[model samples]
Target: MLNTALFMQQIREHPIVATISIAAGTILASEVIWKAVKFFHSQLSGKRPLRVHEVLSFNELGDICAAQHLRKSMPGSPELTKSPEPIVLQCRNMYCSLRNVGKIVEQIDRAVYSLDVAIYTFSSLILADAFKRALQRGVSVRIISDREMVFSSGSQINVLACLGVPVRMPITSKMMHNKYCVIDGVERVEEIRRLKQRKWIRPYCSVVVSGSVNWTRQGFGGNWENCILSEDKELARMFQADFTRMWKAFEKSENNLKQE
Candidate 1:
C-alpha cells in the first residue's frame, strides 16, 4: 500500500490539513447517518418528508417591497384607525400565532407616544422598518439589545442607530436576555423627573408586550413562541421602570467608558 503510505506521510507533514480532513469526514458521516435514519423512519411510517413549499411561509416578512411599504406606512383600516382597544379585557392577552409578524407590526404601528424594546436578538428588517416608521411619526423609540448580538451577522441594531434611534447595551458580561417592549409607557428617568413637576397623566393607554419571542424571522414564523400583550397599568408601569433603570445604567456605563 505505497499510496496509503504516501497519504499518511503527507498528513503527518501537514497536521492542520489532517485535522481539517478528519473534522470534515466526521461531520459528513454524521450528516449521512442522520439523513439515513430519517429516511428509514419516514419509509417505515409511510410518511413523506415535507417539501419546502409545503411548510408555512412568511414571504411578506422577507419581501423587500413589503418592507418598503411598511417603512412608508402600513395601510390603514377602520379597525386600525380607531383607538386601540385594550389588548386584554381582564389583564393580558396571550397570542401564539404561526404568523406573528403582523401582530408585532400592528403593535408597533399603534404606538403613539413611546416604544422601549429590550431583546436578546433582532434581525428582522420589516420590524426594524416598523420602528423607523414609528420614529418618523414622532414616537420616541429606544432599544437595549445584547451586546454580543449587536455584532452578530444580520443584526439590525446598527441600522436603527444610524437612523437616530437611541440604542444601548448592558455593560456586564452577562447576556441581556430580555425580550420585551413597553409601548406608550415612560421610557426615561428624565421623563419621570418631569412627571414629578407636573400633573402626570398618560395621554394614551400603556401596553407591555413580552414573551419568548425574539424579533427574528424564525421567531415570528417558524418557532413555537408565545407573546403577551397587556394593558394592565401596573404591569406596564413595572416594565417601564425596569426599562428606565436599564437605559440609565447603560448610558452611565457609556459615559464612564468615554471618560476612561
Candidate 2:
C-alpha cells in the first residue's frame, strides 16, 4: 500500500523539487511527442526524417533557451559574492596519497605573477619542478624555508634558488615551522579612511594553501597530515604580509647553494 496523499503533501512542501520534477516531466513528454511526430511525418512522406535524432522540437528548444537566459540573468547568491571559506584535506600514512595535492602544485605553476612559499621542511622534487616551471614562465617565486632543514639530506631549497627563485631562511634558534603558500596576490586600490566604511574593501586577492602537510614525500604519504586551501582575499593579504616581513628579516640568509 502506498501513501499517495503523504507523497503529494511532501512534493507541495518542497517547491524546488516540485519545480524540477515538473520541468523534467515536461521535457520527457515533449520528447515523446516529437518522436511520434517524426514517425508520422516519415510514414506520410514515405521517407525517414533526415537527422531526426539531432533535431529538437520548437517548444523544447525554446524552453532550453529560456532556462539558459534565466540562469545568465539571475543575480548571484550573496554567499557567492564573498570569498570562499577554507576547504579541509586530510591524508594518512599507508592510505591515499596526498600527492593528489599535485593539483595545488599545478595551480602554483600556472600562477600569473607571484608565489610566496613558507615551509619548515621542503624536500619534494615534484614541487621543486613546479616552482622551476613557474619561474620559467616569469612568475616571481619567493621561498621561506627553515634554516636547519635547508641543510637536511634531501632539502631542495638550494636547487630551487639555483633555478632563479628567491629563497630566504630565518636566522632563529627556533624553527620557522609554518607550512603555507600564497599565490598571485593582486593588490587592490587604497581605501579612503575619511568616510565611514560601509563596504568591505579587499586590498589584495590571493589563494592560500596551508596546514600540517610538509613538502616531503613522507609528509604526503607516510605521515598523517591535514591541509586547507583558502581563497579569502583578506586572509591571503595577511599571509602575504607575514611572508614579506620574514623575507625582509632574513635578508642575509638567502640560500646561494649551487644546484647539484
- lDDT winner among the candidates? 1
| Tens digit per residue, CA lDDT, model 1, 78-97 | 43344454221111212323
* 106: Cα error in model 1, Å: 1.0
TM of each candidate vs. truth: 0.57, 0.55
Q: How accurate is candidate 2 locally (lDDT)?
A: 0.65
Across residues 177-198, which tens digit of lDDT does each residue of candidate 2 receive?
9998888764311212124353
Name the regions of candidate 1 deviating beyond 4 angstroms.
1-99, 186-202, 253-260
Full-model lDDT for every candidate: 0.69, 0.65
